[model samples]
Target: MASKAGDDPDSLMSLCTIFCLKNLRRTMCYSEGEQNRLQLRPDVFLPGEICDRLVNEYMDLVHTDSDFEPQDGFFQLFSDPRSTRLTRLQLREDLVRDRDLEAIGKQDLMELHLTYCSRLTARGLRTLCSFRHSLLSLSLFGCSSVFFRKSGAPLAAGEDEDEEERLQRHTVDLDFSFQGFNRLRLLNLGGLRAELDVEKLLRPLPALTSLDLSSVHLPRPAFLTQWSERLASLVLYNVELTEELIHMLLQMSRLRHLDISRENQRTSKFKMTRKILSSIVQSLVDLVSLDISGHIMLDNCTVPAFEDAVGRPSIEPCKSSIYPFQELKRPLQFLGLYNTTLCNVTHIPAYKVLSFEPILRLLPQSSAPVSQHWATWALYNLVSVYCEYFTVKPSHQIRFHPKIMSFSV
Candidate 1:
């Protein structure tokens, strides 16, 4: 049967809501002994159901609250509140009622995303542990609900300084163990200010495959080594990267994607030098995607090491003996060098490093020139220098290297 264009998923979901309401009315009719007035409520697509008032409250919070600025109007598009025990619940700058928490404990929720819900206390977080066995994905990004202290506008000078001192003193001590999240696959603990003991938070979740610790206090590097083989994707944006941490990460050979992009423009004292880059390529052989771009301490010395790692032709020695590492174990898919010293296209050395050798490895064995390995290299800082490369476009290709490379604008 040819489905009409109007029978989209959104329409189908609406239809489901209607059917649930009808079912609820019919059930109410039978229970109330044919009462003229019938109350309608939604039914669960799976097993259990949620309160109608709670759904209305969530929708009202989304539309009226400024803090709950969803990425798009499509925030709650996929999961309808009317049905589905495993649903997406987003609450911001509002109190999580005890009844709601109780309801959540009863339902078989798979995903929960709570952001900036300042009124949700530590007790509420404890209550959330009820879903430890069921929840597959959980995000507590920007949620300062556990231990938030309110402050009034400064009436006197130096009051702001006093508040800062007070805030430091009252640092929330959030130490929830993740031992219960046995089935959790993806966890985002971004913007958490409390002390996160790696042993309790990370070691327990053996099934954890992806983690986002952006802007969160990092646990000891030694603790992360436990997940070296388990974790496939890790995001550490703006997290302080010490020399010890870099050395520890070298052992995570199973990591397929790693992002350590610095948020600040000023380079840190701990530079990501050639030695560090060489050690990374040598150690993290399974890495397919890596992002060490932005204002992290990147210098000229690191360029040659990257060129060698990605198999690009460089003025620097590319011989197996000089290079610390063998050919890259995993074909490099993405390289981010935006707003860094290595972004100079006018400079031959920078251009060579930016030439991206990973694309060459992905070239088809057949003689056909059309290639599928498209690599996106971000060079936002070097507009003039990048333009200069196009002037010598043909020079980029050679008879010796049949592999072709294409870059996204």
Candidate 2:
């Protein structure tokens, strides 16, 4: 069936406002069951079962240019207590400003996600405090301008700080408090280029579980020990990984996801050793996802000694040497090792690093030209010592080379 969106010039684009907004923060929300009887009958397609109140309550926003809703009319809508019952909203845009937050402040929202809204300042954060008591999840990634600067902010993430590396520090007087966030669980403050009081900010939220502190400075990550019993997942992308921080992370017995990927943008004083990697894999028994991308190391770091892991397959047919390692005891759903030396190593059974049959099957099945091309290369990379089981056929002819070759089903 065709969508009910009409023949208007902007037929393709439509807006929706629901109680639950899906993102990295899986916030819980409850509908208050309040209906605005004063709202005029809106012209909409036969609304679905739950659509009557949830959809029509905010549909007045559809007429954006004040053609349908006048200033007094908006005031009327705002004055009604029911209008302030919105629970979930994600307003992500460079154009979002402080005034928009002020308007939203009236509502006791449960979840709010705003990323890259650069125009927002400290005043906007003040408005956000209105929902501090009720909010369950909040993500303010890349919205650093909201903080007032003190000394220079955290350096551009490295062992050595350059003049341009300096980032602003948030002073104690930002007029914000985490004290009332009793129900808050998921918090993503990634890309906040400020020297945040890591301990003070987190000491209040006893319920916080999943946190993404990407690009944020944590000179004193001792807070990890405090939250060890509660914190479950963490993303520390581009943040410095010191030995102390590593030790603190190992204590989080409940931690499931850990992404310490450096992306090669900066330098970490600690080079990830095979020993350290093995220790992490062995200790963090509950870990479901682990990423160690871009930290420099020569030896095979992650996959330890086990037999259940599939045999390492290669595309180059060079079985001259195989770094023998056993399978990991636990199951990891995701493992990210991009931009690392392991980019070419395909022995990780946890991630199915480079299983032979999977890459071969993906070749013809991949319909897109780019996908087919990469699948062909993946096949090229899987030339095992035992090619007796598999036959190299060209869906088309190829100038095959002994060392490096092209492949087809």
Best by lDDT: 2
lDDT of 2 by residue, 35-90 (tens): 42233222222222222233233343433434433222221223223423556666
Q: List the residue pairs that clash in candidate 1.
A: none
Q: Give lDDT per model, in order.
A: 0.53, 0.56
In order of appearance, the predictions have TM-scores of 0.60, 0.62
1-409: candidate 1 lDDT, tens digit per residue: 6477356875665555444333543432123234433322233243333333234344554566666532221222223335434355655544433234544555556777766554454455666788888888888876644433323322121212333454443434345677688899888877776554544556788788888887766656677787788888888877788877787788777898888866445635556766777787777877766666554444444335444456543322233222322345533555444445543322121122233333335545674243111122332224235554745355544211222122322
Off by over 4 Å in 2: 1-81, 149-174, 298-327, 351-409
TM-score of 1: 0.60
Residue 171 displacement in candidate 2 (angstroms): 5.7
Q: What's the CA error at residue 389 for candidate 2, in Å?
A: 26
| Alpha-carbon runs more than 4 Å astray in model 1 | 1-7, 10-61, 64-84, 87-99, 147-175, 194-199, 301-327, 344-409
